[model samples]
Target: MPCPACQAPSPCPQPHVGTAWKPSPDVTVERLSPGLPRRLPLRQILCLLPLALVVVVAVQHRSVLADGFGHLATAEWPWLLAAAAATCLTWVAAAVTRQGALVERLPRRRLLATQFAAGAANHLLPTGLGASAVNLRFMAVCGVPLARSSAALALYMLAESVARVGLLVALLIAFPDALRIGVLLPDGAAGPLLLAAGAVVCVALTVLLLVRRVRTVVFSFLRTALSEARSVHARPARALALWGGAITFPALQAAGLAAVGQALGLPVPPLHMAVAYLAATVAVALVPTPGGIGSVEAALIVALVAAGGPAAVATAVVLAYRIITVWLPLLPGALTLGALVRWKVI
Candidate 1:
């Protein structure tokens, strides 16, 4: 509308024009494709290539994959029960770790659900993104502030790593000759190297925790979250116990593999499976893929075979392990994730 002072048939204001209509800010739109060709669609297609490759492999190896179905039949009821017990222990240990890391109280049931859901998502999602996302969402839903939730996640992850490293070290030390046999490690001194690496990681983590400034920066964001977990009792004793559980989690998985080996009647010892299993697991974690998918399966098969298990047997064991540890939980996780969404918990 024209100003009254200079009005000569001024434009009429329509419906609270001046009162409610502040000038809209100018939004400049630049041509992002000025020089570069639009390649995102191509990139998206390429991104899916790996998944396609996995499907092809699965199809090609359908017979071998089908043979893996026999694993369920081979499952000795007694050992299966033991594996189940170990799995339960895994959750118990995780709850303890969460409690320790929170330095506050967390419901055991919730933590365990989070654990299972995270694992399940990790498996179902194309990349491990689904699982980590689930974990963050779960923590948020549990009333942990985002910052403290992050700290809790970091601590929990570290604890899990420590456990894995510990188990690896134990196996390496207990069976030095086996390490000397593996193709993955440097000749004659891998044991010391693995041990050294584990020690270094531990020391670095400890140092990070000890540095006040670093701690402040790393954990400041978690204050709101930790405060929410005020009921969580932070006891050093409990922390250690939780760490113990983290260690056992991997150990239980290893034991499961051993049980599979026995069920398959493979000649390789359980300790050998443990070492190979740990190595493959660590390797898979380093891969960029979600849940390590193709990489994990390949690594496990290679490691198990290199450790003297038959190729088909290794594949079978890995497949069975994934089925039990991954697929079994995925169905429930999807259901829970839906529930979480419906309830706006996420």
Candidate 2:
């Protein structure tokens, strides 16, 4: 074919400026002329929100991060490596728990990846909102209805909470003197904590009773959640996976902190460190800070000290543990989140 400008050559050196762009060979068109607009697909555009958030979080904690890294410098290497390994296992445990929450089996690889991304999101928002949102969206993409997905989420939370508290209770019973249970809860603090918990329960009950719509919604959601929970429990395999993962997730978390404590040469025994980790996390679970930031640090330090570690060393251990479990993987998790979002995996 000849170019419109100069029809003389075997090949046209200058193509018409206003001509339609060449279409991709992959696209099938009914008519060749002005082939379908070669626009980018929705999935092609990479989302930047996750990366931006990672930057903001990093910048906000620059000073604390610098100091945490400084503490890590003096820590033992082998134990730190163990802590990192334990941190990795937490994601696997979470993925298993997520699968056990529903009758449908999610794609294993994608589910695990979503859990990794959810961890990063968890740190960015308060009370697990970020992680819950990510998981809900992923389930929706996987064709799970919103109601069932919500039910699964509720089931997961319930199982996780039960397992965590149960484990804590067992540890306390097994080694009553080890953690100096008295020190973990200061003399006066127990009364206030109990009162606060009771008050919250009372307030929730009051709302449910007073508001008809609220009561109806609560009952409806509970029915769905309980039905799913019962179904999961009926299957031995699913029940095992659900309880095992729920138990493992928190146990691994404690193990990670214990490893960090050992690396820092904290005086507390490894078992005691694990105990402290659980107690501190359970105590601060309701704190509103993103990932329980401030509350976690304080509760952890006190708990570790109660377990017989020096206050300064306990502080160092908490800081270094957070660096490994929370800070270190944050960016990569965010990048993975961005990739998953770009690929429409979640």
Candidate 3:
């Protein structure tokens, strides 16, 4: 008699009509294993979380966003274009500075992308925190030791600070009355401020010394930093990139502000505008605001007003400048950040 399951053949050995045939254990395991639930990567979740927050913020500030766009529409196109160009150059300058800080050469495209992503990150976190975290992670992924990478970060910051101070000094020399530092600082505040800063530094050093582990780590970091600094200085191009990029970064930033002032008809001289930017930024460097958000805007308005700009126009210029430098690039920058996270570049 022919089998019901296999009609062309005789009765089959395995049951196929009322019962199912089972495979061997190995095959069964192999087939079923793939069906087990797999967890999502933590990194992907982290990357998406920030994006969600950004979206929410964008929605909440839609009106402000619209206003910014409106201002851009009415802005003097030539000067605004120049400001945008300067804004673009700031990212390149940052990438160059990062390259100069590290002894090993990083991939060019990834490095620049990192800087762009860092800019977005900077806005999300407190002043400098986002960029520092991104760069630290990037260096770690690129095979740099944590201590050395941190030291490199320190070196980069120091270079930038020195350059900024030098530029501020030069500007003051050229235009002594451009900005009145006294107006920014209240009477009898300078001494207290200096003392407070000194106290903070002393406390920090004391903590480092008191904690044996921290002291050892700090010593090691200092040693690595010195070595890395020497290595960086050995190459002329790298040295120039480090210092020149540092100098150019702030100059470009100031230029962007000046250009925006011109675009909005702020009535302040270009040099005065630059001085105001430098002074405002330096004044609020320790404010701990995200990208110096509220503090920067307030300081900038005050500085510009002090520099002889009318209050209303100064406010407009500051708003427009923030729009150009911060808000415009934010979405694209956020996207770049996510892409870098997905690719494990940061």
Query: Which structure among the candidates has the greatest TM-score?
Result: 3
For candidate 1, lDDT tens digit of each residue in 1-346? Answer: 4534333345544443455433323522234336666555543453344345445544655764565566767766675566556655665666666666675466676667666655645655555576557767777877877777776666667778878988888888888754334466547787786898799999979988889898887566566545533323356666665576678778887887776666667668888988988988876776676566668778888888878878877887787766555544545655655555555555
Model 2 residue-pair collision total: 0
Please give each candidate's TM-score: 0.66, 0.86, 0.86
Deviating ranges (above 4 Å) for candidate 1 = 1-65, 74-77, 126-128, 180-182, 185-234
Candidate lDDT values, in order: 0.66, 0.88, 0.88
The TM-score that candidate 2 achieves is 0.86
Off by over 4 Å in 2: 1-46
- Return the lDDT, model 1, position 106: 63
Tell me the tens digit of each residue's lDDT in model 2 across 1-346: 4444555474777756787655456656655646567766565444577778778888988987988999999999999999999999999999999999999999999999999999998888886898999999999999999999999999899899999999988988887765777777667898888899899999999999999999999999999988888899989888888999999999999999989988988877788788888888988988888878678989999899888889889889998999999899988998988899988888
Model 3 off-target regions past 4 Å? 1-38, 59-67
- Please report how far candidate 3 places residue 5 from its true position, in Å: 32
Model 3's TM-score against the true structure? 0.86
**Steric collisions counted per model:** 8, 0, 0
Model 1 worst lDDT window (10 residues): 21-30
